[model samples]
Target: MPAPRPPTVPVLEVYSTFQGEGLRVGERQVFVRLARCDLRCAFCDTPESYPTPDNARVQRQPFGAKDEALPNPVALDVLLAAVERLDDPPGLHAAVSITGGEPLLHPHAVHALAVGARRLGLRVHVETGGHRPGAVAHVLEVVDEFSPDLKLASATGAPTPWDAHRETYHLLEGRRKALCVKAVVGAATPEAEVEAAAAFAVEHLPSAPLVLQPATPYGDGPAAPSASTLFRLHRAAGRAHPDVRVIPQVHRFLGLR
Candidate 1:
């Protein structure tokens, strides 16, 4: 039998952009967008990542100064090399942001990458869906920051794993890891829903910052939440958790990828 094609390493879309949200807003950062996702949010901007059985249709996009997909069946050494290439000389940006369809999907790879980054004295941050507590713990062990999006009515047809997400949030509690819980506020984000998410975070991760973002105007029928609705949602979230803050996608504002 022909040698089976090597399993594609989880590729990262490495690019430079101002942080669109969270505690490090406006900071210059290298965004590493990992491929693949477990859930299909209706308003998923990167619908291409929705895990489908057919793999041939996966398209590769240009990344930063390099035009290569990440190491398929990636090894720690090869993945580290990609990180090194992202920086000129070394350490040009603020930190490495590990975002993806859901970085947790590839726990082993992410753990390897984070361990390597720490050895190089590079700061690491991870953005996730809060699905896998163990995966989140592994990434959090090496990362400086944890930005987990507590999915609040993601237009994607899949149901949110509230218990799992909540467990991850609590698991990170008491750790020095800076945690930020982000909720995508959309038309579906009712005041009660916002309060529930906020309350859960407040109860579990009281010290972690909570961020509320308006849904993007993308996807088949995406619509931006109104300013009035945002105000109410923001108020409700804040009432539940004093640390809540409203932030929009700043990268979109600056017109960077």
Candidate 2:
């Protein structure tokens, strides 16, 4: 019998762009945006990434050029080629950001991608919603960094469970240098939620930075949080975590996708 091929993942798009949020804000990196998400936050910017159509396709956009649609559930080799095509000198990017509607939803494929990227002399940054701690754990050994979102019910307009996020934070405790907990604060985001998220970070990942991203207005979602509201929320987060910082979506400000 032949060895079974590694299961492929549903990739939505692959491109090279500057990191827009969390600790890596402004850093140039290659983004491997995987498809599908379990949560539906009201402030979601890429709602299009949440659904997996019957004939889903992955868009390959090298160096921000025109996108070329490819078949979905792309193999590791194809994904690496997509990343390589985006690289000007190859292996020049600071990290390969494996982001998603929720990347952890496909842990095995994520692990394979991270391992492959590491072999290519690139750091792997797994950007996840932190809703699936088990999945996160499965790839923790292979991934170099984590950018976990701590969702809030007020912003998501849905129940944001705390257990999984708490567990994932616990797992990232010793990796303070590679861990950044991000919470999206919308115009209607409650100050209490911000404080709670900060407190949770302080309790589990005290050394890690906590980023409060003022939700960027997208789709028919609520407007971005006002400057005053952002300031207030920053103050609230600061009370619990010393490294709390308010950074909005830098790519949105810079007119980059």
Candidate 3:
């Protein structure tokens, strides 16, 4: 019998984009946007990532090159090659960010991709909705950084997954590289909830900084919080976490993807 074929992933797209949020804002990186999500956050900006696309659009070369449409369920090795292809003009990218509708949904593929990216001499970063401890545990060793969100009810339009978030944070304690805990604060976000999230972050993952990202107005989604609201949430967060900063979507400010 023939050997089993390598695993494939249902991908959305692969391209070069700047790290537009959290601690790594403004840093250029290759992005691997995987498809499908477990949660339907009301304020999610990339709702497009929520569905499994028919093809994964990949940029063949850097600097506004036309994207190549590869069939969905792209081969793991092919995905890695696409990532390597974007590294033209050597040393241009600082890292590779694995983002998604919820990247941890594909933990096995994530682990493999992280290993492949690391082998290419690039730092590997993964962003998640902050509620998948089981999946987080599977890819922890291969990943260098974690950007897990502390989902707020006011923002996500769903009950906060406190237990899962706590467990996930605990799993990331003493992490190999860095972790940035993010909470999206909307106009309706409560000070009490923000405080709770801050306390949770400091208590479980004290090493990681907490970032308060003001929700950007999206179609039927949460509206952007006012300057005063942002300041109030920052103060509330700082009560527990020493490092708390209010950052908006920088890529939107710079008109980047």
Q: Who wins the lDDT comparison? A: 3
Error of 1 at 96 (Å): 0.8
lDDT of 3 at 49: 87
Instruction: Give candidate 3 misplaced runs (Cα > 4 Å).
Output: 176-178
RMSD of 1: 4.0
Put down candidate 2 lDDT per residue, 1-257, tens digits, no spaces.
99997578888778778899887788879888889999888889888788764333433544344577676777778888777766668766888999988999999989988988888788899988887889977988899989888888878888877888888888877555346888888888878888878898889878678888887888767678998998888888888788988888899878887
Model 3 lDDT tens row, 36-142 = 99999998888888888889999997666689999989999999999998987756898999999899999999999999999988899999998999999999999
Provide the clashing-pair count of each candidate structure.
Answer: 6, 0, 0
- Per-residue lDDT tens digits for candidate 1, residues 52-169, read 2222211122243325544344545655666666665466767777777887898877777778777766778888887789887766667777887787764444667788977887
Q: Candidate 2 at 95: error in angstroms? A: 0.8
| Candidate 2 segments exceeding 4 Å error | 1-6, 53-65, 174-178
| C-alpha lDDT of candidate 3 relative to the true structure | 0.90
lDDT of 3 at 82: 93
Q: List the residue pairs that clash in candidate 3.
A: none
The C-alpha TM-scores of every prediction are 0.85, 0.92, 0.97
* Position 134, candidate 2: lDDT: 92
lDDT score, candidate 2, position 22: 80
